[model samples]
Target: AEPDPLITETQGFAQSLGDGVDATPYGLPIEYESDVIRRNVEWLTADTISSINFTPIHALDGTITPQGCAFERHHSGAIDMSKDEYRLMVNGLVGTPLVFTYSDLERFPRENHVYFCECAANTGMEWAGAQLNGAQFTHGMIHNMEYSGVPLRTLLEEAGLPDDLDGKWVYVEGHDASSNGRSIPIEKALDDVLVAFKANGEALRKEHGYPVRLVVPGWEGNMWVKWLRRIEITDGPVESREETSKYTDTLADGTSRKWTWVMDAKSVVTSPSPQAPISHGPGPMVITGLAWSGHGAITRVDVSKDGGKTWETARLAKPGEKMALTRFYLDTVWDGSEMLLQSRAMDETGYVQPTKTQLREVRGENSIYHNNCIQTWHVKENGEAENVEVS
Candidate 1:
């Protein structure tokens, strides 16, 4: 083989001394990795303030998403709020309404837990057909993080819950201009919800509800209000505009399905995808993707190369964690033929991810929320991939 000048010759970075420790006081992705970032579709929403962006999952390998580049959805754009100006109110249906300052929250016993929050509309664009061409756009509206905070149950207990808990609800809202409020069942609120102050061991970013936010494990992202402000105990669901007019799923018959809070089992192949297509010639290939279930942990993930005609189980990178993203991979050889790739996730509850056709038969293409249908990526002999659908 001819001498490879690039590697045989000393490169600039190899011989020259690199920057000092202080080069980056606060760390950031190196210049070479700048392309990996959250991206938004310009036509998806009327304005950027109320728009959403997708995580660059195709370029990422691990499960934990860095807060800096994680997908962000804002109803009124990111706000700048200082900890000193933060206050949380616990009122309504409680025995004593109380207001707590940021300092007060810090004094409480804190617990740390990892959870995944997914937008209900993550893959809604594909309901009709293959719309977005990249894995990020199709399935990157989610992120997993370790949160530190006091469990919401502690605060509710401090405020004194009523003796009869049945039919009770907690209507939580944020401090942002939109105030994005949503109701949660008392059982769920008291079970695992957290008034989180920190994510991935640092203060929440302003874009991600700086100072404080509510972490509702295994539920749709809309219910996990950011810039959390108040938790109002109510006799029943307030049937707020968010729940009725927005998040609710419209059926094929035109009837709306309300209270669809949980995100079902879903998975997508990140590599050999439109944005991260195969670059090497026919040989060994590593197929990888993410799988998660709001119902429980993902037990297994199956990959289909011929578009669901045959199935092969992928190896889980780690044992799936409840309500957290699970990374899966399949190591195999490529024969240089056109391939239709797909993945299906099975949660602990035995709910298998459904196909788009199956999903349409049940919910129809009229609805947009909670579209967890299996996705397809058509890979050509040239190693390029594109969003595609197969019967």
Candidate 2:
């Protein structure tokens, strides 16, 4: 008897049966995908214990960011704890203080919504010049997912928000060593905040605030307190160290802007960049990236291959959602010439993403946060790209 050629020719996974069921109870992407991972740039910060890791966004597509490869930023460090040990407390200006355990969080009416959490420092490094080399480093500090949890309003009602809503705010903190507290306007709390326990159909990863985290949609990432523990309704913003010492925007005049919570409209071409070079040379190329606006839905995205000299409206892979990641694609043939690629996102409010020069003309170089300017990638004839600033 002769062997089948298909079976004989096939090798590796294509030839052999995979591991038996339950070989690994919890599944993960195959080992061959090791390069698609969360990577930390050692020189970016001093230590991993109190630093950040870049998400491999260049290797990722679509809106949902996989939990394992999503980036992590720590003031102290990621901690280990169990659901049994988790608890959330609501107090301060509330008429009646209340406390809830992990299970109690499940008792409330829950809703699921997908939103993007982007660190205010996502593009912070690009404030002065094109420093980082990859889209993962420049724009990787973000992840979008479907969160399951009770609305903050429902919990606030349980605590009985006081009659005086005139000048109230909510102070939230995490249980980690860093605490990582932040204040939010009471109105926003009543509007769209969520006490999320799960993300993308699973309980959040420990680095992402595990048992619970605040979902401050349409706002900066700092307000989404992870491993959430306490919420205090206050008469005024706490003006906490997190808010004052950092997270504030600096004006060229040296006057700092406080409480700039909303993340403005922004987008970037993820593929054909430094880490994700154009491996398949010179044929039909599909340029794609992610876009979102804190204010509202992304209405349009424009791509300029000539460094803003000419623009083409890219097709949105799907309709954009409010405060959520929107995927856009520009399918066109590449002639192998060099290109300075850039993307501009337009929100429903008619706000177009500004260029680096436009933003610098207003804010100056002293600011380390909120660098939402359009990002440009210099693509060479060899199909490799590097982060570059277009004048």
Candidate 3:
């Protein structure tokens, strides 16, 4: 039998005393993990300024996405703004328009919750077919974080909203060059909307809307305005460029559906995928992935290897939470044979994740956002995986 590597084989890292904590001031992933970083589809966007990069979901596990490795969608490129120069204002239809400095936000009570932020276009590229070859590219436009900040309702209450909330909406905007404003119903703004300052237990990253951002759980990532600046209450939706020209789903008849915010239940396998192909030979293979729902908590996740011809329930790695990413796994033995790997998520409301065919049947192929279809991966005998569709 072979002895332990540390006892029999020599390694420089283990043999010598490494640098102390003071050497790193701030920590980062080791050099070996350089490949585990945000990636962008350069051809998809016109320029990096208003471009997006995917989170390396294939290289991650558990629910909390690391602040440094999370995905970023920059409308006008990431900015560097000082906390001293930040201001948040609550105007329109209020007692008196109130302004708050960066310091003022800290005085309010804080709350925390783990939530998943998914761009509605997470799987939009695959609407026609399995165009992307990796899970990171196909389903990486999402992230989960523990947000710590005050609820928007508290600030709205401070500004004193009208007693009759009907026919009222909140128009929120960011401070970046793009502004990225969108309207939200008064009901959702008062329900679970968060004015987040911290994510994953630290100050928000500049790429993830530093200084401050809005955390609209279960809604499309576009509505989660980063670099948040102002909130204006009004009687109707803003119908801004983002809501009208972009983000909306176009149906078969050339008409489009607007105001579609909630992200439906969806799931995707992470490991043994195209980007993270299996290196080890057949034996015990742990199939794992992330499941999330904007509608509510993920009730259950099911995995299928034969293109959904049969299904087996997968175990939730942890208890599911509302508007948060849930980890799920199916501990099984792979025989090194070919497999059509797939995952389906069921939300608390009993809504099941649909397939591309099912989605196209209802949505048609002309849409761009909110394509939460179940993704499929074709695994070959050599343990290589590719984005594929099953008949």
Q: What is the C-alpha RMSD of each candidate to the true structure, in Å?
A: 0.9, 2.7, 1.2
Model 3: lDDT equals 0.93
Per-residue lDDT of model 1, residues 39-127, tens digit only: 99999999999999999999998788899888999999999999999999999999999999999999999999989999999999999
Q: By TM-score, how accurate is candidate 2?
A: 0.96
lDDT of 3 by residue, 163-193 (tens): 7899999999999999999999999999999
Worst 10 residues of 3 by lDDT: 21-30
**Best candidate according to TM-score:** 1
* Candidate 2 lDDT over residue span 1-391, tens digit each: 9998867776777857877999989998988998998888798788999888888989998999988888898888988879999989999998789999999999999999999999998989889899999999999999998999999999999989899899999999999999999999999999999999999999999999898999999899988998999999999999999999989999999999999999999999998899998877788989999999999999999999999999999999999999999999999999999999999999999999998899989999878888899999999999999999877
Candidate that would win on lDDT:
1
Each candidate structure's count of clashing pairs: 0, 0, 0
TM-score of each: 0.99, 0.96, 0.98
Which window of 10 residues has the lowest lDDT sum in candidate 1? 61-70
Candidate 1 Cα outliers beyond 4 Å, as residue runs: none
C-alpha RMSD between model 3 and the true structure: 1.2
